[model samples]
Target: MTEQALLLVNLGSPASTEVADVRRYLNQFLMDPYVVDLPWPLRRLLVSMILIKRPEQSAHAYASIWWPEGSPLVVLSQRLTDAVRPYWTEGPVELAMRYGEPSIEQSLVKLAKQGIKQVTFAPLYPQFADSTTTTAITEARRVIREKRLDLTLSILQPFYDQPEYLDALVDSVRPHLTQASDHLLLSFHGLPERHLHKTDPTGSHCLKTTDCCQRAEGAVLASCYRAQCLQSAAAFAERAGLAAGQWSVSFQSRLGRAKWIEPYTEAHLEELAAQGVKKLLVMCPAFVADCIETLEEIGDRGREQFIAAGGEELQLIPCMNTHDSWVQALVTLCRRAPQAL
Candidate 1:
């Protein structure tokens, strides 16, 4: 067998809660073309303006969620990689962040130095998105290409609707789903409206009508983030035995004032409270691992909002961090036969 390396990638977090560290992290993350999608000059200006004050606010959130071990997202990602590496005797596994210290370049360099020629990049996002999955792949390729290293790379496809992926998702969340809950809100991260339009092949389907995303098929469904997000939610609902009116979907962690897909998670939480829904179960199917968004935003701030608006309990179902099923599902995704690039 050819020597190989498995590179697991995820959206990164600051090394610490220091404001400077958080600011630098945000700069790298937001500067990516796929992420901000603004022209260079305008993007720089906007990001600069954001950096002036947003870092302090972000620092506080990161502080509140900071685990003793480290950032929960980074820690869980490493744990997943550590578990999977032992199973794959054919290759060693390494974790990389597209925008942090243990970065794509750092991981690639170490592997290249070790004579690793073939690499499989498992972008942790279950859904396809230009910002998350696409950016990670592009950065990996850039480092390999720029260094003129001998490397063979393959990527994991979106597993939002895959059976094993869905099964693992259900397996991880099943323990948390309660018959006493009035509704299950499967919240996903938000992307700006333009992103949906940009990825839409027909340029007519996404944002065309509310019904377009509801019908998940064709190229749009395959690549459109909105479609895949919805698909994951629906599949989880079905597999978890959630009946109609017992489950709903919303988008969370939205940034900067552009219109993102709705219903927004915070607003929806308020609405659910007003509608006499008392017990709400919240799960972030979009994120396989828990992070600041899930821990502090949803678990802390979101819970406060819901209760303040007249709801009893808003429990956050933990993400599939190092769950056995999720780890097994990840191995399946990496070891499965490769698809054509």
Candidate 2:
């Protein structure tokens, strides 16, 4: 029997919490055209400026979330790979990162050396983003092209609205909803509004209005993170049997000075607190695994901000990391890839 390979990838973390390591990681990450999407000289200047200060601050943020084994994202990714290995009868399962160490190139090389003929690239981003999934695929393609390998490649596009994914998300959060909370906040990582406008084929797909994401009839919803976020929130709410006004969506993790998709998570926390909505439950559906963004930003700082603004009981429902349902969903995804291709 010929061997096939499956590679799972994610937005990577710095190897260590050291400032220099963080700078190097940020440089590689932010330098990707899909990530920054700016011209060379300008992007270079901007990245350099950020590298000087951002790394130190990022290092501190990472330190808080770092596990004794390693970064939570990488560690959980590896665990997921392990959990899914038994389900892949075709061949071995490996993990890689879109940025940082144990890169996609190295993973491909290892599989190539084993004479693998078919490879599936699963860039584990639930939502499609040029900066995330596209960049990983481009780099994997570049590696295959450079090596002149004979491997056939297939990429797992976004599964933000997939039923299995929705089930896994519901399973992850259902238990937490038992507690009393004013509202359920589904916070996704934000992308710049300009990116959405540029990517919109019809030029009017995303008007940043409340009604903009409610368009479920067209194909525009495929690439719209805002729409997907809302849909996931709805699915989770329905599965959890929550009322309509009991939940809302927001975006977080904005970069640069550009305006990103709103209502921003920080701003929403303030608004909710001011509106006398105490005891909130927050969940980040954008990330399948808990990392710095969720652990530090939402769990720590977000909670502090909510409390400081006159709210109480901020609870963060963790991502579906190494959960049986998530691992099973991943197995199902990989198993169906050969048939889909």
Candidate 3:
């Protein structure tokens, strides 16, 4: 039997709340071409400017949510890794971050040393995006080539429309949905409009019409982040028994001057509140773990904004972090991943 291992990768967090640490982490994260998506010179210049003050503000936000053990993302990811380990059965389970410590390089190297012949590279993003999924895949391939590691990688493709994934999402959040909130906002992390066009295999298929995502089919839909998100949200709503008016979709975490996918979460918050929604429930389907984006960005800042906007309460439904159903679902996904020679 071939010795196999499961490796899970996620978006990394800063080593600490310190300004220097946040700056270092942000620099690595933003410098990736897939992320900033600019010419080398222009990207460097833009990121340099962003580094100056964004770090301090980000550091403060990190400080606000930092766990006693470590960054909540790192901690929660490890917990998920631990929970899934026993089920892998094939071999050991390891967790790595796309950026920062415990990187893909380090994890691959460790697996090689353990005499692992076949490894599954799972980028923990349900929806396919060049920035998150592509960068991680590129990094893993880079390590294999540069370091000459003798490991065969079976990559896990995006599971946006996978039945197991949709089922797990609904099962995990059912508890939160039990309470009747005025509305449920399915908020996914926003992507610049250009990203949608850039990833479209059929360039003319995306963002060309008002309902391109709805009309998209086959390859166009496969590469479309927005289409995949909408699919996931709609599937989850149906499985969770949410009515039409009970739930809506929006995009969050817009950065820079670039236009991102709309019904922006920030604006949507106010819209819901103004429409006499006294109680609002927000779920970040973009992230499987509750990181700063879900915890601080939505839970903390979002809650404040919603209440101030005349809403009585705003509650963030936690991600399916370490939930037994999610763990089982993830293992099933990994087992079904196609192998590469």
| Model 2 weakest lDDT span, ten residues long | 332-341
Q: Please identify which of the two predictions, 1 or 2, would achieve the higher TM-score against the true structure.
A: 1
lDDT of 2 by residue, 166-231 (tens): 899888788888877798899999998877776676776687566888874356777776777778
Q: Tell me, what's the RMSD of every candidate?
A: 1.2, 1.6, 0.7
Candidate 1 vs 3: which has more lDDT: 3
TM-score, per-candidate, Cα-based: 0.98, 0.96, 0.99
By TM-score, the candidates rank as 3, 1, 2
lDDT of 3 at 265: 95
User: What are the per-residue Cα lDDT tens digits for candidate 1 across 100-193?
Assistant: 8699999999998999988888889999899998899898888988988778887788889888899999999888875578888988999998
Candidate lDDT scores, in order, read 0.89, 0.87, 0.94
TM-score of 2: 0.96
Flag the better candidate by TM-score, 2 or 3: 3
Q: Report the Cα lDDT for candidate 1.
A: 0.89
Candidate 1: lDDT of 312? 98
